[model samples]
Target: MYPRVILKETLYKKSQQKRRTSPCNYKERIFMLNTQDLTYFEHRPRKRPTQKGCIELSHIKCVEIVRSDAPIPCDYKYPFQIAHDSYYLYVFAPDNDCRLKWVRALKEATQCNNLFMKYHPNFWGEGKWRCCHQTDKLATGCSEYYPNGAKPLPPTPDPKCRFLDLEERIVVALRNFHPEEDTDLPLHKDEEYVVVDSSEPNWWTVRDKNGNVGSVPCIYVAEKISNDIEKFEWYNKDMTRTEAEELLMRENKDGGFMVRDSRHAGVYTVSIFTRASCIYRSDGEKYPLVKHYQIKETEGENIKYYLAEKYVFSSIPELIRYHQHNSAGLITRLRHCVSRNVQNSSRIKELSSEKWEIHPDELILSEELGSGQFGLVWKGYWHEQQVAVKTVREGFMSEEEFKEEAHIMMKLSHTKLVQLYGVVTQRSPMYLVFEFMENGCLTDFLRDKKGCLSQEVLQGMCLDVSEGMAYLESSNFIHRDLAARNCLVSNDHVVKISDFGMTRFVLDDQYTSSYGTKFPVRWSSPEVIRFGKYSSKSDVWSFGVFMWEVYSEGRVPYDNRSNSEVVEALNAKLRLLLRPRLCPQSVYDLMQWSWKEKPEDRPSFALLLHKLACLHQDP
Candidate 1:
């Protein structure tokens, strides 16, 4: 049966032929969506329209939004794709609403058909399929399919329940609520509601005591518990301010205590005891003094807490708990009391072993090499040998976690991988000693020597990184953040992969990040960017971007786009532009091979290393 015509509009169609040669050219066309097919007509302004193309409803496998990164000349507001049998028809709409209307209509039209089973949310057209290895402009090698190369049956929808058996939660409005939308429920202060559906984390559908049934923001209400003890702990303070202070003083034997900031309401300042001279005293003589630890409030008022303006915490309890585990800042003095008790802990023992541990005194930190979220990297001397010392920021990481990371780094060693020498755990900021690369980071080196660098040098760098990645892949490790910035170069121009902070040892080669973990978007694979699912193949995707950076002389990938834009562009199946005049097409082909829509379709680092080696030999 043919799909009904729901909408028709005059739009510009990006010519497939023109896109390959002159990407800016767009022909005016009239797009019509009917029950049976999507038909496009050539728009001759003064004359009658003539049908140019039609995509049958039966052949349409998928319809999706395209967030293109490609340098298309026309500023088409909303670009989308319709994939059918190995080929994708890229179309652009005048607005986002128009695109959404078309996409929704198309999805609804195919909902009852088998074609709907092959639908993908983000799948868009890539130049060609890696499976068929076609480079020809007009070649359509393989049909559009999912990662597995088979069209699976559509998922069974969840059974509809007439009435949910979930508990009816009664809550009172904690504050005045204003509804942003017609479907949103507005509540007066102290108004009550019985929660019908608390499925959504932030918004809950509630039936008010007044019989109103609408969604209300979860933060606007509080649970209506009968007993004071069952109420929110923040509101359950029975002790007087004096009594609270007394208890806090007693608990904080080492002199760190939290008190409400006199200057700011709803803000608390943590004062930690330090031997440093008080602000009032300029005398060199040091005495016990309490100093306020700078706190940074993030996003929502009660949600996030940052210690010393660095370590992030979800709440006050989380912040206090972290400090209790790993005393730092002015609280470092308390380490004598804390570390002495936990010194024999299994984790500390694992990191403190004589073979892997180095005395803090031996690590003479020199000039700072670089700084990151974790801490700073310094060019230093360890046992008279030059080393790169990466220090974990005082409160950013706990002692136990830092030690575990050190243990993992020590286990990994390869010629093309930076070697972790030992860890210095005697101080507040723990030091991880590693083999110092005389040339510093690869990105800086490449950028500094940009036009002066030879193709052979760039090719060698790619091979070096691929070899390092291959070793990690074989060892069942996924380097989640593999880029030129994370790779270091030696005095002899040997490039070795570094930055193992995001690396994980996985038995299955796939590692999913915990919710809220931030990752660089430009170098990430589509799977990694969308789902945070990382594997060696994902690393290969990043390696492709890294190779682009190398060839471009350290130019940032998607330099013109924001992280969110880069993520959107990747979802659209757009990739870094190839410098055909500067680099060989063969090398660019390898980059494309790594950027296949399917992660499995991407080449392994081992295969990539072999190919790079072959390229090196040919050069």
Candidate 2:
């Protein structure tokens, strides 16, 4: 606590003046704070409360020595050294026990590892200073010392301090991850497409906003270049050679013309006037710019424009249509002969300067929120809005596969499901931009409370979950993977489902030969486990198990039994033994209704929703 440091104007007494070393260098004494002074302040009593303060004492320490070889080098001992008026506090303790103790404290106070103690005049005086753990939230030099200088500051204000808010904002961008917005691709004008670049599987050379070069997923790139191109052709097959020449003359009044062999395919190979002259179009009709250049004999390679060769199967009318399609600039035909491997490596090793565009602040990584198997999710700001960015390991998936998955997710819109705001598929591991959930997953909360969710609360949760499933079922969607971890609970106990990565579009055929069980095996319906098929009814079966989880206070279902035991019990059609203390007959009745053998016999989600709702009404 800072005491009233009213610097009173009093002539120095004889003893105090004598102790001050009179005629000392006008260079003011740099009152270096030491360990003893820090300890004394902690134990001292004062007239007025210290203003969250610390004190420093000078000229009491041992003389400074330059040790050439004192068995340990200073630099080696201190990777980060503090030089505050010659009194250094090594933030990193060298000993294992002490270091671990300090590390734990720092992790609790602030997760950031790059903690730098700064001197702010308002918080600390000219010479004396105190500890303020730097955090990503507050600005640098913002003191962590509490208003009362309490040893351990009170927990950060919640629900903001719920680690989930920070964790949810992290997103990882992988190679081949593309910006879904603001870039043009070859798609219909009305179609929504993410900006994607097919770069190397591992495009390491990255240049961030600060011009600092580092290795990162290609999806982090904000912008890239689009090369415009066009081809030319003529289609009037009925016209005589003279008539064709006349038509060519009329069209070529502007600038360029060229032509080549049109002898093989049904359509003739011809050239005409275009953007740069040598645009190729399937030949038959006269090109407008043909008159720009006189026709002359040219070698194979020397031919600037080569049109399709005319053949018996080729129709002249079709060739005319092809010419128009090329002319419209709406179609861009990519040739297989053009090697992406060769061009990507030799021509543009890194992204072009012109192609580089700014990503919404959210797209740009701010700080490493955390790391996981997929990759790292960084906390970032997009358009001044907060978002979590998940970047995945490079080459984890194909670009096409990632894009297909993203397409499915983007098309889906449900309040019960977590929304997919943006996606990048140009990178190897794909990125999903989602609205950050303030409350952490229900799993964390359950684990924290020793899995002791009250019976009433657990029943209410069951209703929320069923309602969410009802919505999904109405949309003809199956979560495909539903578990306690996937179910998110807000601080206020509202349940919402998330993580549709494994979700698939349910078709009329209903059954898939892909997996024996489309849903999680542990929570799977008996039919799913035995016959390898799942429908909305199967989801109801899983919901029954999820209810068991909540009712049991999150005790692992069938935990004490082996996999074989579970399989055997289910095969014998055994009902799960519910804890009577926690679950009432109503709970048992609802679960039994859902866990019926046949899908047709099982109650619909709407019916289940009604029964669960009635439970709440009963209370």
Candidate 3:
């Protein structure tokens, strides 16, 4: 393969040496790309081409279309660059298609080489970079560089070791999903399956337990290492330390035990209730203490576990069997295994394929919670759990319209954002099921609490909303209707961002509204109110006013001002709301930072979250 030709073309070329002192004149050249090397020859009229330079393909680190605005003194103006061995060679083509063809072919030819993770899109010219204006020639690229320009394939499984690595290779379904198309495979919650191919980021080809193979969404399943214990009576996988203690205390039974996942990932702890009848508190009540023991694992060829080093068992069940008959080193022998579902508050699987789109007949409505811009909000029940239902008022929006909102809502999941359980779109008057917020909307909660709220509480609300907004920003979602009225308050006073009325998932972080698209004028950034431009940073501007609402005890921004007046005020590039009375200067400064005139000047939601978190640590 030494001299096998891959591509042969005549093109205009610039100096191969990247140094500022190198020759700058453009000249015609005959370029030949072979399996082993790329060789360019000096153009000679009706004579043998004289070889000018040769570069091994292995030396090529980058091949891409260069972003440039320099005057081209050649017939071909479409330029692409090849970065090899600390130097760049610019080759000009007659058209963009020709430039892209060379760039793509070169990229494919060098796909397997060790490559750079970052690159400057603009040309590094005149002893400076055009993209970021860095003086250093070897400075890190201002943009992310994706090697191979494609999703990586999962390592192929070796036939001999496939079954031997079952625990690590097999993924168990977290929820049920019926096939929506020919490509999709039906998934049953908790069933294990083997991944056949994971070349697609969201969808993976998998083989189920019954040998049924098909494509499934990668998010629907996860690898569960110790799946054998999932069906055990004593296992409760999703409870916290406090939750375990509460469960054991409620039972009021000594020696009652439950094995739960530890706070530290991939670890387990055993909690047991042991009581001393004579040990009484000063208030004359018997004391109950739940002893927690971390199950220690020993490193060896075969993994083993034990509460005490002396009595080790290969499995947790075996250890439970031993401790059941004898105390050994425990405070008491394990007895009366506590189940998770005894109380209705047990953890519900967050998302599953079958749970997202609910049948309207299954929802049970009781009392009216409230009403909003979309429709009437009602307290509803589904799967025996209380949820808030937001109905789409007839004529307000159709099933197709509501489905777009639901699709965006389903992809998002964060503690601070109001959780969307599912939707009912198959019938008339489509509705959405969301986690109920007992304390109601944030605006109402702020008004009701007013002077009774502490500084910590106000700050906590800001942090919670910022955290949710940060998640949305990272997820490339812009909550165009972000406001205090749109946020909800949980029973524990946890503030969660809600009402994604104008939400859009943008890959490029920018979205333009249609001619008649509606948005909150009072809370929108300048670009949005004027040009109808929206981005995550635009959402940050809305959050500044949201923070103002919390600090001002729910006072509306530009009180008594009309929507047109608010737009005019934003157009004038002035603050719409002043600092709240008794608000911290540092916090007020951050609010102003979020309300910058340009969206790019405003901080990201992630950065806002950091600033608020830092303020949380403030006195």
Candidate 4:
């Protein structure tokens, strides 16, 4: 029987990338998606289309937007990716509607097959995965993926963003508001005004085109974004290097870029992506480099800004405009502008803003996930997804402590870390909402799946925790309590570090009378055991114990010893965790390295991360 046609269109496809090569260029192809298979053919005008490839629907696992800011080389700007077997096929559509139509059709057609639970939201470029920076092509996805393509509850709407009033420096009065007092500005509908000061929560200081200035209600004016620097999609005032790469890679456009403020005051930085770089990673993939050029200015009467130094322009905008059309000594020309909205930056902002104040009514607590020293954890459903709800026990933490930890959690975001969904602060007992983990704690997971799991999986679990710790170390933060029980396992078996905020809470059994604070004796480093010292190295020592738990299939460190006894063993530097049964020699060696008596001698979590990434189970 002939294949039933579902959708067919000519599109731009990213040619397949081979190992150690620069990013492949885009080529026009005629794509046809049908019941049995999806195929693409080389399209040439006035000639028969030559079939290029075919993918069985069963082998297809993921179909989603290639959220990227890299400039598209093709006329069709909107891009999507297909993950089939071991390959990823990226294609572009004329517009967002066309892109979504194809994505939805493909998803509906392949609903019955095995699909990924998590997928990288950005493209794999240079030598690493853009979103997570994982080098392996088959690395576990960093973002949750939905088979039904469900989106998170739309972040509570911002009243300030209504009718295009979103971040506009200049706005038009929506309707007439006559001045009631001399201080108030009289507004006329559709009359233009520049917002001079918006520091007042509800009011703004504005200057009319005629230079008349006074206070006005923020609600009376709406943004007219057709002109202005903030109006340009490329301008991102708060972007950092990491944020810039995330934005550009999410766009998946080769020349995607943004103009952000430099670290220095009064200077702008142009951050752009180039598919190929001069350097290559250990994986032999050409490093996909995100290049940031500080817009430099000449010391002259007619000041000019330049990125290449040789290519100077009259103004910053003129320089940007010139570089858009010319590579001119840089890696790539700035081809497409990706705004922060595409980055969902506002949602990131909201995590720390008033929007973080989740209504107590929205949460529906069901089965208990676990009970801990801090409080009870319940498996709950919010906005159609399972979540873990942690209730802060009364007297467990002070209002000051809770606020401090909440602030820390809000700042931490990583694939290996359990995400803090939101917090409930209005009620008696404070609550923290987190992303749900299906397999519970790593301690329990290793216990249950002990013999069934391979050495690779065990190592991966360690890698996950190490990655999280590495991030903590880099952030100048410390996870004082790092242990198997403090990590959670997702449904796909990806491990994530959790309960990081619980280090402040006192665990009854883990407390030492001399220390005046509670820290798990078995996992505690020598310094922590003696001086109650907690640093990233101390966390690394704890990580050694955690690794021992993983390879030993959840066997407790110092299982036979008491807290006092374990402290003595650590204090003397005579005893350390023994190699778990069947643990790789290299891994065990690294574990020992992490447990060095001197904190300075212990390898940093960042170094440990590199060591773990380099290891493989003996063939």
lDDT of each: 0.66, 0.44, 0.74, 0.73
lDDT per residue as tens, model 2, 394-443: 54433323443454565454334565667654443456666555555666
lDDT of 1 by residue, 105-186 (tens): 8776656545534333222223433223355523532333332223322212224522331677778775667653344678
Prediction 3 TM-score vs. true: 0.46
lDDT of 4 by residue, 93-191 (tens): 988778888988999988888999888867776567867679999998976667666643221223464222245487777578775334467899867
Q: Model 3: clashing residue pairs?
A: none
Which regions of candidate 3 are displaced past 4 Å? 1-354
Candidate 1 C-alpha error for residue 407, in Å? 1.7
lDDT of 4: 0.73
Better of 2 and 3 by TM-score: 3
Q: What stretches of model 2 exceed 4 Å from their correct place?
A: 1-361, 364-380, 426-429, 515-519
Q: Which of 2 and 4 is ahead in lDDT?
A: 4
Residue 150 C-alpha lDDT in model 1: 31
What TM-score does each of the candidates earn? Answer: 0.46, 0.42, 0.46, 0.47
**Cα lDDT tens digits for candidate 3, 377-490:** 999899899999998787565333365577667666556778898987666567789999999988998899889998878988898888778767766678888899999998
